[model samples]
Target: MTVSVATSSRDMIEGALARAVQFPRLRYMGSKYKLLPHLARAFADVDGATALDAFAGSGVVSYLLKAQGYQVTSNDFLNFPSAITRATVVNQTVKLTAAEVDTICGEPADDRDFIRRTFDGLYFTAADREFLDSAWSHIDLLKGHKQAIAISALVLAAARKQPRGVFTFTDLRYDDGRRDLHLPLRDHFRERVEDYNRVVFNSGQTCQTRSGDVFDLPAKSYDLVYLDPPYAPPRDDNDYIKRYHFLEGLSVYWRGQKLMENTKTKKLEKKYTPFSYKRTIVDALSRTFEQFKDSTIVLSYSSNAIPDAGTIKDLLGAVKSDIEVREIDHKYSFGTHSTAQRRDVSEYIFIAR
Candidate 1:
């Protein structure tokens, strides 16, 4: 199943490594931004030229693989994250121009008051809601990678402006007086556009992005597959759509989505994912490992999760004989205090082949 690549020169590999660091930082939950160095080192020994990031939450791991010159495929069920990978990973040279940015941030041509009517005083200010409705109208006019870039910027802007970068709550209870909260949504959009643009670089490899259930992907073989599924913690929940429903709706302009009118936050109904529930997680992991058994697999799990590190190793061992585990002490920035008073936990990496 290993895809052979032409031998890369030392200079070429170094150049790729250098470009990997240019990826922009995100305030996303469960992001692997701080562990990039650890991930890079773990992947240093991989001899493959093709890799699949099965659950590219923040797309940082996919960007890392692409920078290492692996023809990377980044997949996420969430449209906002998929848009991010589309803008950065799949999009090599396409960038949104100043005129395009201005157009997207300008007034709407028609009286589209969807956000204003649907979300008045719920998430953002009145002016911000008007701007969002206007920007989404202009964003729809863009095509291909340009549209993806705009969506990515818009989503990032909304996340940054929201207190704690999530939509699970409407109040500023957890407000830490951060600078991102004070910034206007439109200003954040403009700044994020520049950040995404600066991260765009030619990796000289054809990368791709997919938005769907992981099992729905075509049965394509890659030399390496990285798995970082949502950790179903022993306590609390990992419902991403609940925390990001606004961004998800905005990603597709709520075309086919129906808001749950009974919900306090006006959030959409939660999408079903086996990885998020303790009852289905073990089976889900087993199936995932068995599906990609032909490829070298690297899994990231947490100490506090439902299926412990030993259970994960056992699951991987069932597919591959050779196995190795690496442990790193990592502290999460966001989590429910009800789970544990301390945020510190051990991050586990399991390599199976």
Candidate 2:
């Protein structure tokens, strides 16, 4: 079925698009970047002044909601994505200055060699690893959102430098001769800083961010809550931490994170989340739905994921009587299969009130 956009909401969406131009879009897996138009249409008629992006993976949805005039709260279990949301969504006026960027990219004050030692030959080159070491030292010196902005840029730069923008495998085997893969990590960091800075604007609403389990979120009322949980695909390839451990480590500079030294990639010990596993996903979904039952719910899922569309609808039906499902044809940019094997799938948006 077609979802119509309210005229006022359409105007807000146009404003959102204009603001989004400067946002340094990530080639992040499962990002809603491509489906934003569909999401905007789904959100257009939803009655909400306050919204929660519960699984704010790339923070784009929270930014969209912000542009549409919602006081948004973006949350993610991963620190790296949380840093991105902090830089763009929660942060209102803070922008990294030219001096700050130079300081971040400049030589380190002390010899800190964590990335250099632990990840010597894993994801980035020796020079890039050394640059990351220096950048991490300076990034920690900045306070609050400025630090977050720097971390966000660093994470983006690292991802851009990597082939397919994932840390699942080492070496340049998947290199596609993209310009981003050739640029120095430092250059990528500087460019990303500018791009992120340009996207920073006052949404005229006090937005915030949360970094923790979805269940840990305080029982609070919002006009709406948007959920885009990690889809439990038939295969076990939706392990975001397994794919993004390096970026996650970069976000926190590996502090308090246990590195699985025996692994070839030197990834961090996997963080626990009920949503990523088949055994716990149904209970997780039920809990999430019931926890925010007072708010209008907008859930994003994939046809390739577990608990299929009909099952999800029934789950939501138990909580709210009125429900609508909208589907958009989509193809993911990155997958574990060949291009020919990567089939088109329906991205489903379940709206309930």
Each prediction's TM-score versus the true structure: 0.94, 0.95
Query: Predicted candidate 1: what Cα RMSD to the true structure?
Result: 2.4
Cα lDDT tens digits for candidate 1, 148-199? 9899898888888887677988777767888888788889999999989998
Which digits, one per residue and each the tens of the lDDT, describe model 2 over residues 1-353?
Answer: 22222444556777776776456888777888888878877777787678899999888999888877788899989888889989998899999999989888888968999889988778788999999999988887889999988999999999889887888899889888989999999999999999888888887788899888999997889888999998877764677878889999989998888989999998889888887788889889999999999989999989988889998998998899999999889885336535425568999999999
Candidate 1, residue 322: the lDDT equals: 95
Alpha carbon lDDT at 142, candidate 2: 87
Query: How well does candidate 1 score on lDDT at residue 139?
Result: 87
Per-model lDDT: 0.85, 0.85
Spell out the clash pairs found in candidate 1. none
Q: Which residue segments of model 2 deviate by more than 4 Å? A: 1-9, 337-340
Stretches of model 1 off by over 4 angstroms after superposition: 1-18, 333-342
